[model samples]
Target: MHWLVLIISGVFEAVWATALGKSEGFSRLGPSIIFAVTVIISMGGLAFAMRELPTGTAYAVWVGIGASGAVAYSMMTGAEAASIAKIVCIIAIVAGVVGLKLAS
Candidate 1:
């Protein structure tokens, strides 16, 4: 359950990140609200998950998920360029996250 929450929180981190970019320094109302809401949820879940998981493993996995999710979303939306190198790097991040889970 903690791991599940942690993973979901990681995805919310990506959502908040993307919404922040769209918020345009909080000038936009909709995305700004989205950012605010998701950020809270993300942080709360992380804090909760940290109670059971090792800090290092939890943090690394959270960051890995968020970073890869944001990059993947941007690539899909054409907001960022897609390249073989970038894809490989995202895959590496995912692999690391999985490795951490298995190690734990």
Candidate 2:
């Protein structure tokens, strides 16, 4: 179940990152609160997962998920421009995340 926790943590990482972007330099109250809360939870979950998962593996997966998810979310929400190159980069991040997990 460690891997499950790690995945959940990664999801939370995505959430917090998106929230941070919406927070608008922390001027927006609601998103700011959400950003803070999710950041804490995401890190907490990562700490728990690290008890079993290797540090390199867990950190790479966490960062990869956050990066890819943020870009995808931005694209879907029309918050950022989308392009073939962006999509390819997202895929590459996914592959790297998978490769790290598999290597561990």
Candidate 2 vs. true structure, TM-score: 0.94
Model 1's lDDT to the true fold?
0.97
Once model 2 is optimally superposed onto the true structure by TM-score, how far is the C-alpha of residue 35 displaced, in angstroms? Answer: 0.5
Q: Identify the candidate with maximal lDDT.
A: 1
The number of residue pairs in model 1 that clash at the backbone is 0
Model 1 Cα lDDT, one tens digit per residue, 67-99: 999999999999999999999999999999999
Candidate 1 matches the true fold with a TM-score of: 0.99
Off by over 4 Å in 2: none
TM-score of each: 0.99, 0.94
Candidate 1, 29: how far from true, in Å?
0.5
Query: Which clashing pairs does model 2 show?
Result: none
